[model samples]
Target chain A: MRIFVHTTYNHRDYLKRLYAKIVDVLKDSGVMVITNHDHEGKEDLTKSEIERMSDAGENVLDKMDGIIIEASVQDSEVGYLLAYAIAQKKPILYLYEKHSGAKSVMGYFTNSKIPDSVKIQVYEEPDLPAILSDFLHRIETGESKDLPTIKFTLRITPQIERFLKLKAKQYRTTKADYLRDKVIKKYMEGDEK
Target chain B: MAKSRSKIALLFFGGSGIQTGDGRIFEVTKKEEITAWLKELPELGILADIEPVFVFGGPASEVTPALWSALAKKIGELYPSVDGVVVTHGIDTIVYTGAMLSFMLHNLGKPVVLTTSPLAKEMQSPADSEGLVSDYRNLGVRANLINALQVATMNLGEVVIMHGNRVMRANQTIKSIGPGQNFFEPIGEGLLGKVDFGIKLFGHVRERGKGKLKVDAALDDHVCTMRIQPASHAEQIARMIASGCRALMLRSYSTLPYPQSFIPYLRLAQEKGIPVVCHNLFALKSTRANEEYILINDMTYEAALTKCMWVLGKTREREEFRKLLYRDVAGERIKANV
Candidate 1:
């Protein structure tokens, strides 16, 4: 799964370490982590590229399966991106460095109004890996309810049923699972609105 | 406690910068679609109550004097209703549009912000893909738009271009040549503001509610612009004059003893009663104004060129055109030394 990680440019030493640790944990778990900082042979994007996609009406968050933001340093850009990701309804994990003296704006997401897709956690450096792993695990296992849960019944013609069976067999999965994972998920992710 | 939001009229002239996901630029053809689109980004709603005003749908390069006139008139019409105006344009000709509007919109009391998104370069390899997603989170159209909306609501009033962190005067803007963080820069003390932790305005800015809005969108597009080269010839000027060119703007060497071969062409333009403007020519010492050509030292090439079109549109008589050209119609030029 693809994940986008964001952090502030402030508090360079602490935040940079926190960012690197998060990337390492995510990478170890086989998650494709996208970040603006250059690391692991990946160069940061030029200003022009960012502007181009933005101009093209493309949001980078749309491509990600999930988002992780380090909110120990409050920043306007971080806040904006968080709001954008939340609006996009992507599963988000907000990490706040414990006792950093900076508050996570996510505190405003009270229980009543907070969407199930958003999770807030405070972490000491040592507990960060576990917190991130649990979040990613929940997302992957659908325990976080990121995947479609409600059941729906549909009638299918014989020709369509044959096509579904063939595609499911080729992919080595049950027809229901194949249709849900490939067709439905793809459609949902690629939907323009 | 909640405060009232500023009502910003977003004059949408379709540019590649503000295009939507359906491969279509943001055009206010349907009110419902525009409303839904705005609802998708609630951040803009938090910043201001944006009313989308459709002007045109095309690349910035296609923007013409007529479009500039229309935009100025639209701003004038909306000035009484909205707190400020944000114009979405293509990055290619956004500076020119900004420059023209700075002149066309007269006695502006509210901010007129022009913004555009840069087009991305083609990715070379698989590794380049990460940059695309990561960069979007940091800087993109959304960040620029947010900053621009905030600038639109600011106390300052003037025509400015917002890109990245820089807020520069429209006429004084020059498109940066190489790969740099900033796409545009101001000329001659032209930076109106910068967006960092918050918007910070430099001292030289027109405050909001200072004057009533008026538009002088008159423009003559028959002006010819030429850059002097070592091998430049006079025949080029003759052809331009023959093709109904009313005014000439020359990008000359910074330090000039102008090439001797171009003297007759200067004389020719003078004899033909065509007004000539020499741009980027720095005087070594105090020099008397040459009747043959008007010298522009401090203005950007885009501003000087657009100003010529504007001045020509206002008048055709040689002396009158010269007078209007140097009149500082907007803050496009530095004050002349007495």
Candidate 2:
């Protein structure tokens, strides 16, 4: 699978470490990562060169299956890039360093609306590659959680129960199926309760 | 003495819980099904003459300013014939729609209740356990909708959320955050009423308008929001402004001293005649008046974002924009010296 990895220029050392570790992980694997360690292009690059580099970044993002961004660095440009990635509905994994005292990058999505494809993880050094590889494996195997499920207990009277059973018999289905259909019917019913 | 029944209009837009079964498979939802469910209960008829209008169906993310404008228009056209209104919407954007409706209505003489079910579940007869039968099979989604409909019949003269037995003022309502919280909460003054056995309205009920109904459907669509974090780049703000971000909801974790680096960007946005409102999330302490040039006021985070979108829908003029922002259209803002 082809994936894009984005990081701020501030995380050059972290990106280098990630690149080295990932190359080892992907030795025989089919995963291809397009990451530009030189996030901030050459200082003397011409306007056309800069535009071309920006276009190249966007093009890589366009073809990639997903994105992995180093959220540890607090760069607004990383945020801008993430916004574009999200608009594309590509699965995103937000990786941040385990920190103390300083604010966690995880705070970004606390109150913000999050898409189901977005995942955030905090990591310490040695397990970074392992965790990233594991996330990718699960992503490929469709093992990651897709949606959150909620459970609740309901209370209904005997009459409603009998009514449901009778309706189920009338509809030639089990009571559970009948109840589910009724519930669906409720939402379909005009707009009221 | 018997109370006269109300002619209530229930407008349906889509929300999460009702659209899915335990947030999974998309369960079939239709207007007639909802009516059949309601008709099963005899108590509902005693409350009011229920009129359900299936406007649209989608998740909360599908809610747009245009949908809100159309809703305002629908309510205006129907208010003369109906006693009150109830809206079933997605939990994520319920507060936004509620706040928008509050401003759009300006001065609603009758109640406009917005309610959402955070969990929609299916019940079985419990494997030969008719022994454990009672009122234990009611889902929050159904119960919350009934409560909302009941509140709508009461003519509360405000947009509100009726969850379980609690009646929350719409503009003042904030989505509940933190652990184990799923419903929207009323900030500051707390809940407006309770339906323990009967409707118990508390204080803070405003003096409502007595005359004609007014609907402000002229909403500008060029508004957007950006959060100011510890490392939020000013360049992003500059780009947003350049891209015709007519209004901006500049938000922070709290109303602490805003970063000085943001000042130049703020000035640039202002120079382009775009107004900015700094919204404080989960505000505890009072905001300092450092950024006086930018209108800073207290509002439920949901209300601030929705109100920004609502205000933009009408006018982006500097004077009218600020007036709409600061003004408490249907008690959405705190009475501050902004």
Model number with the top TM-score: 1
What lDDT score is found at residue B70 in candidate 1? Answer: 91
Q: What is chain B's TM-score across the candidates, in the order shown?
A: 0.88, 0.83
RMSD of 2: 25.3
Candidate 2 falls in which docking quality class?
Answer: incorrect
Model 2 DockQ (Cα-based): 0.01
Q: Please provide TM-scores, in order, for all candidate models, with all chains considered together.
A: 0.63, 0.56
lDDT, candidate 2, A1-193, per-residue tens: 7666665455367555664565445433567665645433223234574354332211224445667776565443344344434434456777766751123333333224455566767777787667677767756765544421334466889998898888775543457655554555445643653
**lDDT string, candidate 1, B269-307, tens digits:** 888888888887364322633655778776778888888
Worst 10 residues of 1 chain B by lDDT: B120-129
Q: Compose the digit string of candidate 1's lDDT tens values, residues A72-115.
A: 87654555455555545568888788877766565433223566
* DockQ, all models: 0.05, 0.01
In angstroms, how far off is B205's CA in candidate 1?
2.1
Q: Which of the numbered candidates is closest to the native, going by highest DockQ?
A: 1
Misplaced by over 4 Å in model 2 are A1-193, B16-43, B120-139, B178-182, B207-210, B253-257, B281-292, B336-338
Model 2: per-residue Cα lDDT over B1-338, one tens digit each:
02344688878776423322222322125665555444333333434567778766766777888898898899998888888888878777888888888888866888888877543323232232221111112233444555666667554788888764568888788766532213556776547886422345787765334667898877777876777788788788788987879987777655463587877887888778888777774444443432334445577877777777777777877678777777777777665422
TM-score of candidate 2 versus the correct structure, residues matched by position: 0.56
